[model samples]
Target: MLSTSARLLRLASLLQSRRHWPGAALADALDVEARTLRRDVERLRELGYPVEASSGVGGGYALGRGAALPPLMLDDDEAVALAIALRAASASVGGIEATSLQLMGKLDQLMPQRLRRRATALHAVTLSLRTGTPLVDAGLLSELATACRDGRALRFSYRKHAGETTARHVQPQRLANYGRRWYLIAWDIEREDWRSFRIDRIEGGLQLGDLFAPRPVPPDVAARLERGIAYAPFACRITLRLQGSLEELQAALPLWCGVIEPETTTHSLLRMGAETPEGLLAQVLMIDRAVEVVDADAVASDIGRILARMSSVFSRDGARVAP
Candidate 1:
C-alpha cells in the first residue's frame, strides 16, 4: 500500500488529469475502499483544493474552481512540453513575457536536474521566425477565449484598418492564429454577420454581457478564418484558372493562401490577394502548373517582368563551360 502522503498526491494527479471521476473507479485506481477515498478527498479540500462530490448512480468527483491556484503536479514530459511552449509564447505572444518567465523559473526549480537540462536544451535549439507582427495582449486573448467557450456576449471597441473606431457587440466563437497574429472569429450582433476582429486592434476593456444562445459556427473554424483573411481588401487581387483537382489545390495551398472554388472536376478557380502584384505572381508560380489569368490586364506587367528575368537567366549566350 502507498503511504498516506503518496496516495494523496496520486489521487490529486488523477483528479487533475480528467474533468470527473466516478467514485468507484477512483477508489479502484487508488486501491482504497470508499471510506478511505472520501477521507483523501476531504484532505485535499482542506489543502485548498475544491473537490466536489455528487451522490447516486451517476455520482462522481470533480475538481472545481478554487479561490486560489493550487500547486499542480506534472510528469516529466508535461513539464518539458510546458516549458518549451512558454518559451515560444514569450517570443510570439504579446504582453506576457514576465509571467511566462516567472512560471518557467518555478518549473525549473521544481524539475529534477535531468529534466531541467532537457528543457533547457530544447529551448536553446528552437527559434521563432516571426518579425514585425503586432503583439496581442495575453489577458485580452484569455478573456476572449473564455467568452467563446462560455457562449458569452462581448462588447468592445474595434479599430478598423482605416483607423475608424466603433463599439462592437459580438458573440465570440473562436480564437484563431494566422501569419503570427491572433484573431477572434465572432458573430457581429449589430451587423448581423460573421466578422474576424484582430486582437491587437481591440481597444479598451472587454465588457462581458449576458449568456447568449449559441449560434451555429462554421464547421471548420480555421478554414473560415483563412477565407476571411484571404478575402479582406488588399492592394492587388489575383484570379487564376488552375488546371488541377480541387483536392490537389487545397493540399498544396494553405487556408490563408487563397480561396479555391471548384469550376469542374479537373479545374478550379483560385482568388488570392497580395500587397504587390509581384508577390501575387510569385504565389501563382508556386502552384507549379500552367494557369490562365482571369484578369490578364491586372498582372500583365508583372508577368512580363518575371518572364524577361527568366529568359535572361537561361539565355543561350549566357551558357558557360566548366574549366
Candidate 2:
C-alpha cells in the first residue's frame, strides 16, 4: 500500500489520465475506500488542483483548470524522454552543469537497474563535454526564439568579428544551432541583406520592435551557417590552395575547419581562419603532403620562426616520427 503522499500523487495521476472517473471506479483504481478517495481529492484541491466532484448517475470526479499552473506528473516514458532531451540542451548556461548533474542523479536513482546503467553511461560521457565554458545566455536564447516565432523585428547591438560593435535592425526569421554555437539568420534591415549573426556576440538583450510578416527563409540555411561559422570570428583569414578536389579536401578536414571551393578539376581552394599565421601553418602541416599557401608570402616573416622550430625538431633524428 502506498503511503499518504505517494497515494495522493498516484491519485493525482489517475485524475489527470482521464476526463472523469466514477466514484467507485476511482476508489477501486486507487485501492482505497470511497471516503479515503474523497479525502485525497480534497487534499488535491487544497494544493490548488481544483478537482471537481460530481455525485449523480453519471457522477464522479474531474480535474478542472486551476488559476495557475499546478505541478503536473510525468509517467515513466515521459520522464525518460524529457531527461534525455535535457542532456543535449545548452550546456553553456552558467551553473547549469552542476544542476544538470544533480537532476541526472535523481532521475537515475528512480530508474530500474537496466535503465539506470544506460543513464550512468550517458552521464559519464556527457558531463565533461556539457559543463565547460559558458556560451549562450539561456534566457536570451528563449527571447530570440520567441522573437522568431512572433515574427518580430528586433534591435540589438551586434559585435562584429573585428571587435567592432554596430547597431542592427533585423526581422527575426530563424535561429540556427551549428558547430555547438547559436546563429541567428535574419533580414538585416539596415544592410538590406540576409545575414547570419552569432548569438553569443550580440551585445545585450534584444529590444523587440513591432511584429512584422516573416520573410521566406532560404532553403540553404544550414549551408550558409556552416560557411559563416567556419570562416568568421577568427583572428585572420587563411586561404590554402591544395591539389585535390573540393570533395576530397572536405572529407579530409573538419566541417567547421574552413570553407572549400572547387577551383578546377585538378585543384581546390580551402579558405580557413586562425588566430595567428603560425596557427594556420599548424593546421596546414596536419596534411601529410605539402600544399601551396597562397598568402604564405604575406606571413612569411611571421611563420619563419615557427618553421625553424619545427625543422629543428624533425631534423634532430633521421628516423621518422610515429604518425
Candidate 3:
C-alpha cells in the first residue's frame, strides 16, 4: 500500500485529471475507504486547492478556477502540446507577449528530468516559421499589469515618433495585446481624457499611485480600441459593409484593426478611422473582397483610381491579371 503522502499526491493528480469525481467512486478508484478519501479532500483544501463538494447521492469534488492559478498536472503529450503552443505564441503572428514564454520558463523549471528531456526534444524539432522581433520588456509588462489589476494610477515617460518626450499620469485600465505590441488603455489624468499608450514607447520610473476605483468601461472596450487603432492613420471615418460571418471577419482582421459592429449573423458594419486618404484607401483594399465602401466617398474614389492604375501597370507588364 502506498504511504499517506504518496496516496495524497496520486489523489490530487486523479482529481485534477478527471476534473470532477463522485466521492464514493473516487474512494473506490484510489482503493481507500470513503473516510480516508474525505481526509484527503480536507488535506487538498488545506493546501489551497478549492475542492468544492456537493451534497446528495451524486455528490462529488471539483476544483474551482481562481485568479491565482494552481499548479497543473500534465502528461507527456499534454506537456509537449503546451510547449508547442507557447513557442507559437512567443512568435509575432499573435500579439502574445513574453507572458507565455515566462510561463514556459516556470513550467520548464518545475518539470521532472524525463519531462524536461521530452520538452527539449519537442522544442528542438518544432519550427515556428516566424521572424521574432524585439518586443517590450516582460518585466515592464508585468509591472503595468499589476498596477492595472490593483487599480493604481501610473506615471511613465513616453516618447513620440517625432522625438518629443513627455511624462504621463494615467489611471491604467486595460492592457491590450495587438500584433507584436502591447497597448494600455488608460484615463490620461493631465489630458482629462481616455488615451491609449504603446508599451514599447514607455520609459522607466513607472510608479503606481494610490489605488482607486476603475472607471466604468464599455462591454467591448477592446473592440472600440481596435477601431481607434485601425483608423488612427486617417482623420476621417471610413465605413464598409463586410460580407462575411463575424467569426470569419474577426479571424481575418485583428482585434485592433477595425470597429466591427455586428449587423447580422452573416455580416458586420466595419468602421475604420484613417488619417490620410491614401491610408484609408489601402485599408479597404486589404480586405479585397466584395465589401462596399460606404461612409467616405473619398476613400472609395481613391481606391478605384489606385486599382485602375494598378490594372494598367499589370496590363503593360503582362503580370498576373485579376479575373
For candidate 3, write residues 1-323 as lDDT tens digits.
Answer: 78888887778778789778998888888999988989998998777777888979888988887556666767678887787777765554334555787888888997888888877786788666647575676667778889988999999899864468999999998899877778888999889888888788898659778888879866767766776576654565678798887778888886544777788888888887666666666666677678875676656676667778877888775685777
Please rank every candidate by lDDT, starting with the best: 1, 2, 3
lDDT of 3: 0.77
TM accuracy, model 2: 0.61
Q: lDDT at 321 for candidate 1? A: 34
lDDT of 1 by residue, 32-70 (tens): 999999999999999988999999988989999999987
Pick the winner on lDDT between candidates 1 and 2. 1
lDDT, model 1: 0.85
Task: State residue 92's C-alpha deviation in candidate 3, in Å.
Answer: 6.0
Please count the clashing residue pairs in each candidate, in the order shown: 0, 0, 9
Best by lDDT: 1
Residue pairs in steric clash, candidate 1? none
Best by TM-score: 1
Best-to-worst order by TM-score is 1, 3, 2
- The residue-level lDDT of candidate 3 at 52 comes to 86
Collision pairs in model 2: none
